[model samples]
Target chain A: MLPDSAPLSAATATSPAEEVLTVEHVSKSFGDNHVLQDFSLTLHRGENLVVLGKSGSGKSVLIKCIIGLLPVDAGRITVLGQEVGALGHDELDQLRTKVGFLFQSNALYDSMTVRENLLFPLRRHWMADRRGQEESMVMQALDDVGLVETIDKMPAELSGGQRKRIALARTLIIPPEIILYDEPTTGLDPITAREISQLIREVQQKYTTSSIIISHDMNCVRLTADRVALLVEGRCYAEGTFQELQQLDDPIVREFFV
Target chain B: MNSTILAETGAITNFAWRFFRHGFRPRYEVQELLYQCYVVGYQSLPLVGITGFIMGIVLTLQSRPTMAQFGAESWIPTMVGLTIVREMGPIITALIFAGKIGSSIGAELGSMRVTEQIDAMEVAGTNPFKYLVVTRVLATTLMLPILTLLADAIALYAAYIGINLKGVTTLALFTNNIISTLTFGDVVPAVIKTFFFGFAVGIIGCYKGYNANKGTEGVGRAANSAVVVSSLVIFLLDLLAVQITSALGLN
Candidate 1:
């Protein structure tokens, strides 16, 4: 079994004062059932912010809004100094290159091999100089996630943990300024989950990339979060460091730690 | 119920409008388009060929005894040729095309949507609509008519074999009879209507697949609805084409 606690390293301790992404009072609803209501959060230049919530508590919706996948019903989501809601289709697509998203399902293209999957974004953004170096770039990304051997394999051939790692590698290939991970550690064995948590930390330190990870897994939250925001009933019910939130006396906050 | 159907029709029209708009603008997806054409057109030829052959033979055989009863057995070549050229050929081939191509496109796209592959494409800065929808829709639109034409030729050959089974006619005489029976009006209008049939199949498949909701079940639903809708649209369009052709004295 993997250790339940992850002590923060020195590199992740000092985040720059610049805010990279801000969700200011954003709200979204599907018909009568409102998923997100005036929820708000922020990510600094280099930090891992975890949004903790129950299965249907609007965490995915929040991420969708930030990525401009779903239009917000109210409020503003600004990413990399531009309002996400204000951009046109092409503009939003351009903005997406700077921000990577890791889906809970991994979302690796079923039709493609690992190398092709990694090459997808690099080619899409038209990084002209990446032509000769594309092979090396793919190899290096696979190397980062310690899956260089699986470079030529299809996604379906891998185990769930391996698939997750490959998915992370695919995202890291483009090296986005901020990465959004949706349930990064769910549906994994404890050891694999712990390893992914460590990989997440390694990615943060190496790339100095900010991340907003959505998860209900307390272990993932404890291991990866620099600051944890508890999303309760479509709002940020509480916000603090894991240790700070762990020591809170309130029943709602304490429920997670216990 | 009426309102729901109207809403669906309105939604499909809007979807079609988007397809037209994005289809023209792009760093066009040439590679994907070629691959789709290969899959949709080349792969479907054998099935279309076999169906065409059977349809031709069956129609010839069934019409033989009836024409013989009317002492018009010698007119079998002309009658069969006209029927295949004007109506049965396009409608049967289109319905078959709808069943094969439409359902396949719908299921493929629906699977992509449910698995979030489409969303991943968007988030990765590739236009999913351009890469997936446009390529597929265009492939069907172009491929269906070609398939129908090929099917019509194979069908004509089978009809010839059927005619030769009981009575022998020289190829020259058979060719002359068929040529004399079928006017430019018969061939042109039939061929023209096929393009619309092809477009309907492509567009309906794309629309249903693109807009499918739910999960794995939705994939099946999209495929099912695509065939149903495209087949229906094919008949309706055929009816309208026939009416217009008659009005213009083309038939």
Candidate 2:
């Protein structure tokens, strides 16, 4: 097996960088069922790392633990050099401003318009002196996502693909340093999924944001990922570039490629 | 089952503590608070008015024959005035408020929870409790008494109408009798209890909704549980208020 934290062959795109997020020996269990056991991974700055897993392989659990939505049973998660569990509530809230999360459902506030959605993060973090700049920042984010026309519309009025785009725009509004994408392209047609994948790459390049993308879609993995990690039975079974992992002879890793 | 009950109680207590803690911070949600007040207070006036009107008419009609049988027919104004003012007005109005506002808050928050809107808010560095729970709780705590006051006024008018339909008491005489019967002791205790009623409704609804799980079905469950618990809590609080008021000779 390749060594842990192996540099991918396509590492030419991103410059050498320090670690941004580190999940070390994290273990989680629910009653009698163990979800994640001894899982460790480090996310380098300004690289797209796609985590590939099967349907019930605890991908969402990992994301939840990282964001402190769920507490880990027996390990530590450090984001931006701060231990996730060590921070108080307000501190965590402040830290989250720099770490954006794109949920699988888009999680757009249905009660809010697209403009309101974009403004939510800016207003919540209490970014003062954004009077005139707020409008332009919102416009820029919407423009980046190519959905400036949807500013006045509510999330319910948007299609599935449009909702995904708007959700990404909401995350990008604040220009977070690290983004955690939970199944960014799960519930869409292939065309839309491909488009979302391309957008993910565009976001990574444009913002130079380090992202940990958890997805099962091969097309998404192929288009967005600079490195791929195979999570089997709650552990990182292998890690390499898309091409490196694609040529593996192991059946479990081969199952994904075939 | 016992563990579940204990866990739930503990959860609600923690939720209440966090709500108060978060409630006392900056970044206050002034717009949302005002909007909730308008929703929980202003929009509920019509329902509370109709219910109060019906209650006045019915209580007057039902108690009339009994008062007449006791050779106390002339005491109709005093008796109806006291009953509606001291008990019926606050209790019935509070129950109606609990049903409408409590269920609405619960369902709204539960839907937000299931759809991950609450998570989104937290991730975006917004305190959902301060924005959603505190504003709603404070609105109900402050508005229920006002609504009860309005309902009491409407009910008194309907009582006046009820009296006119049967007897020939002048408006001045009816007004004098009501004013004389309802002392500060009677009105103050009754009104004071409604604040508690409002607090209970708001807190229970928020607790249910914010902690709701089990997906779409949980939304319905939260709404249902909110109404049931708040309504029950209202009765229990009414009983306690009566005892305290009686002990203090305010009844």
**Over 4 Å off in model 2, which ranges?**
A1-16, B1-3
Kindly provide the TM-score of model 2 when superposed on the true structure, using C-alpha atoms: 0.96
Instruction: Residues A1-258, candidate 1: write the lDDT tens digits.
Output: 212222212133454589999999888999998888777888998899999988988999899899998999999999999999999988999889889899999999999999988988787677776777888999999999999999889988999999999999988888899999999998999999999999999999999999999999998888899898888878877888888888778677777788
Which regions of candidate 1 fall more than 4 Å away from where they truly are? A1-16
Across B1-251, the per-residue lDDT of candidate 2 in tens digits comes to 99997897788778878878888888888998999899999999999999999999898888889998999988988988899889999999999998999999999999999999899888877788898899999999999999999999899888888888888778789889999888999999999999999998999999999988899899999999999989998999999999999899887
Which pairs of residues clash in candidate 1, taking residues 3 or more apart in a chain or in different chains?
none
Backbone clash pairs in model 1 (N, Cα, C under 3 Å; residues 3+ apart or in different chains), count? 0
Worst 10 residues of 1 chain A by lDDT: A1-10
Q: Model 1 residue B193 lDDT?
A: 92
Q: Write the per-residue lDDT of candidate 2 for residues A208-232, one digit (tens) a residue.
A: 9999999999999999998888888
True contacts kept of each: 0.68, 0.66
Clashing pairs in 2: none
Worst 10 residues of 2 chain A by lDDT: A3-12
